[model samples]
Every structure is written in structure tokens, then in C-alpha cells.
Target: MLARMLVLRFPKEVVDKPIVTNLVRNYNLSFNILKAHIFPRKEGLMVMELRGNRKDYERGLKYLKDIGVKVESIGQGIRRDDEKCYQCGACTAVCPTGALHIERPEMEVVFESERCSACELCVKTCPARAMIVMFDKAVELEEELA
Candidate 1:
């Protein structure tokens, strides 16, 4: 099955609080939260993952909107770029999902696309700028490749 995911970027203050807990309790939804760091900036980004039907996803989005979380962007499925990767492992260190892993034996790194929530932390942490989170339209184009 295709796992559906969404990335919502909120102000640092909003995410640093108990809002996430409230979201879980109030919406009755399960989510994996990731802290992302986009380029040209030092602050982190917040990505939320939701599972289940389209209706459920939509409901969660409505809840987010009501609460005034400014969503930076949203996408479905995993996003990564192998060509841009330099295997530095900085992205792996900061990945909340453990989606990116570095194997010491070969000094090789792997990106588990299935586990990625498109938080863009990898994108930010990669000094080489290899990782990225493709937005809506881009998501469609990449689906076939994925």
C-alpha cells in the first residue's frame, strides 16, 4: 500500500510547546514528528505523518488549520535524491524517523524511503544538499519512479 504523509511547517514557538500532544489527543490520530532544518537558515522544520483513509487525513488537516499552524508545504510518499548525496551521514544523525542510516563497515549510507516523512531534515543537514522533499505537483511526477 502507498503510505500517505504530510509535512506541515510551523513556527518554532508553536512546535516547541505541547501542541503535538494536544493534536494526538483531540484528533485521535497517530503521527510521527520530525524536526527539519532547511538550508540558508538555522531553525528546524516540523513534519507530521498521518495514517489511514483520505477522510482521516483531511480531518487532521482541518484540525491543524483551526489551531493556526502555518503549513509550509504538504506531500504524499517519500522524497530523496541519490545523485545529490555525498554520504556524509549528517542527515542520518538528525533524522527523527531513522530513515537515513549510515553503515560503518562500508562507510555507506542508506535512505529508507518507506520510513521517510519528508521532514526535509536530511535536505538541510546534507552539506551536499542531496536530500529534498518534493511538494504536491512534484510528488505526482516522482510517484512512478518511487
Candidate 2:
């Protein structure tokens, strides 16, 4: 099976359509929506993880593109600033994927970027503003990390 974190941008014209539903019904894909802001008659943005077989996943991507959904890989969109963090663990409380968690023995917060779904919960919950959301600069941030 192939599972990937994706950032989907739906244009206003197609925002009301059942685009994601078609991916499940026609392409045999399953999705876990981490975050979404959809406005009827306006644009929509969603962060989700789509899982399915390799061939089905490819077909689903094509289908989304054909229908005018802009798709992008969720590449290093969230980062934790160790210098600014005080190990408060507030981010861990709201992190749905457990990407941000406290280390048992050391009592320190650990950020696992790979496990993060780009949900932005940690960014909002971090009291120290250590969790940074870099959606617009995601590609550049990925390059910097590499």
C-alpha cells in the first residue's frame, strides 16, 4: 500500500463538488483529513493523508488533477524550534498524530516531522511559538532541511 500526506487546493469553481468522495468511490482510495477549511462558493484547502495501492494512488492523483484540484506533497511544512521551545508539552496535547510528544526519561518534547500530518495543531498550541507552519515556503523549507 502507498500512503502519502497531501495538501489539496480546491478552486472556487469546484469547491462545492464531491471531488474527494470520487477519489474514494472511483479510485478506491481512503483519506484521513487532518485539517480543512472549505467555503462554499469559495476556495478550499485541506491537509490529508491518502492511502491506497500504488496504481490506485496514481490514478487518483490524475483524477484530482483532471478535475482541477491542485495537489502538493506535505513536505516539511511544520518545524519545531528547539531554541524557542521550553518543553511545555502543550503542543503534544493537541497533536492528533502524536508527532509532538514528551520523552519519558528526559521529560523533553520530541518532534517527529515524518509522523506529522501538517495538521497545524501543534503550531497553534505551542505557547513558545516554537512550532512554525511554513506552508507557503514548504518547498524551500524542505530544501533547507535536506
Candidate 3:
């Protein structure tokens, strides 16, 4: 499954009257949304996670752009890292969408990509920083630098 995380900034008038419900109703692709309170308080930040075929995803982006929302950043093809995770539940607690969960028996962490709202709280909260977020390309982190 291909997934993308995008941060959108909206104009004041549009932000005050968010068209979330309308977008959800219109889009055929599945999506999760998260709102962040940033400076210029009313401006608002919207994080969207889209899942489906490439064509559907592209169509969704165009629809959002048509609504006057500015795309701040776009990350693609992200997947969770189960092996590096310890089921600590820290990520789950921080996740606004409840996308991460600690499952028993295997004592591993599970991720529902479709449920991820792209808030990025889990990424910041993870002690191990094991949760991998991939864009169009993979990132190389040097442990020595840390």
C-alpha cells in the first residue's frame, strides 16, 4: 500500500471554516486528518494521510489544492518498523489518531497506516526513534552523529 503524509496550511477564512467534513464526503480514497495549533493561531495546520491507488491519491491532492490549501511538505511510502519497536506504547499514547497499538502474545507494536493522521507526535515521542518515515527516498541516519 502506498501512503503519503502532507502538511497543509490554509488561509484564515478557510481555516476558520474548515471543509474537513466536505472533503471526507467527496473523496473516494481513505484519509486521516489532524489539526495543529500553530502561530498566527487561526492559520491552522492540517496533516493528512492518504491511502489507495496512485491515481486516487493524485486526484485527492488536486482536490485539496483547488480548495486553496497550501501543501507545506509531502512524504511518501512510509511504513512502520515493528522489529525495532518494543511495544512500549509511548507512540500510541502520543498518536492523535490511535494508529499505533501494543499487541499482546507477540508483545509487539502494530501500526494502522490508514488510521495515521500524520500528526508526528509518535515520531517525536519514540525513545528509540524506531518508527521509520519514508519519503520518495529512504533516509540514512548516522548513529555517530547522534
What are the root-mean-square deviations of the candidates from the true structure over C-alphas? 8.1, 5.1, 6.7
Residue 11, candidate 2: how far off, in angstroms? 3.3
Q: Compose the digit string of candidate 3's lDDT tens values, residues 1-146.
A: 55666677676657755456555556556767644544453665656666667776677678778878787556543366766776687887887766888777886678988776556567778887777666531231212112
> Using alpha carbons, what is the TM-score of model 2?
0.77
Clash count, one per candidate: 1, 0, 0
Each model's lDDT: 0.62, 0.84, 0.64
Q: Which run of 10 residues does model 1 get worst, by summed lDDT? A: 35-44
Which candidate number has the best TM-score? 2
* Candidate 1 Cα misplacement greater than 4 A, ranges: 1-4, 7-22, 33-47, 51-73, 76-80, 136-146
1 versus 3: better lDDT goes to: 3
- Candidate of highest lDDT: 2
- Quote each prediction's TM-score: 0.54, 0.77, 0.53
Ten residues in sequence with the least summed lDDT for candidate 2:
137-146
Q: Which scores greater on lDDT, model 2 or model 3?
A: 2
Consecutive 10-residue window with the lowest summed lDDT within model 3: 137-146
* Tens-digit per-residue lDDT, 33-141, candidate 2: 8767788998778778899999999999999898899998865468888999999899989988888889999998999988888877787678799988867745443
